[model samples]
Target: MDSSNWAEHLKQDFSKIRLRMLEKLEEFSILRLNPKHFYSIKVEQESSLSPLAELASINLESARMLHIKPYVVSQKSLHEIEKAIKKAKPNVTINSKDNELICSIPEPTAEIREEKIKSSKQVVEEARIALRTKRQDLLKKFKNWYPSENELHSNKNSLEKEISRYLSEIESEWTNKEKEFRQLK
Candidate 1:
């Protein structure tokens, strides 16, 4: 089952055999192959004879047709063959953005939020109170360092600065979004 000698041994018209193989092959996996899919692959006998190969060979009137090659898949080389099969198959998406996790991850829902409650309601309520007390303590500490008017103006200025910073980030994000949208079309 030497693959190298197959071209000489294959006496049938390549075009006619290919046409019949495409039309008569019942298996989705085999029928999906086009001549483009056969490129660079060498045909060899599959363990002397398999029923599918025998049928394919008979339909094509060539024993050499039974000598179809496997893609020589190994753990290391399987990805390449899988990629080629995916390309040959219809409606297959390999690492496509439309179905990717990054694009399709659902927004966290109320059910997910409720699952985070592991403690008693009283304990959670106390914890919330404690956190509020700590925040108030920090605010009081800041107040001691500045007059109330100065602190109020300082907070407003800080908020304006933060808003400007966020606006810049959003502008850059929108620009990238537009470019991505255009490329998709």
Candidate 2:
């Protein structure tokens, strides 16, 4: 497969494995250090079956990384597993070791999105300020000489257009940043 396709596949596989590992690990409060490389399962001494190794088998080469040794499975599963292991223990090796099982979880932050939103708000605020300033300058220039209604409306419209140019520039900058942020993820 191509690089991007392979990366997507790996991402999907890791996501599923991480979910399952997290759920199972929560039972024992056994924090998985590198779940992507190691999985920890608790088994009771009484149980003949190997609960840890069973899950480990699904992800090959993961055994070498299990370092947290002598983890106890729940008392109930231990009893059942002991009976099952009588028929299965020989098939499962008894080794306790934790290794690098780094879990790769992708977490996206809202900071970038928030920044874009703030920029948009800033653009509007700036436009309002510019328009207000222009109106003040116009009033000063007319200096008590009342502008006719048509002349006043036309002047205000023209000033608004000038204000909009700055607003458009701010909007374009925000858009470019947003696009760049999306690509980073």
The lDDT per prediction is 0.33, 0.39
Can you give the lDDT of residue 113 in candidate 2? 44
Residue lDDT tens for model 1, 1-185: 12233223222222333333323321222212223223433222333322222222211212112122223434323334334434444332223222111101122244532332222223334433443343344345445554678764675455345434433543454344334323321
What RMSD value applies to candidate 2?
A: 21.3
Q: What is the lDDT of residue 87 in candidate 2?
A: 41
Model 2 per-residue lDDT tens digits across residues 26-107: 3221111233322333444443434555423323333222222223434454344333333432323333224212222233
Cα error, residue 179 of model 1, in Å, equals 1.9
After aligning candidate 1 to the native by TM-score, how far in Å is the CA of 13 from where it should be? 68
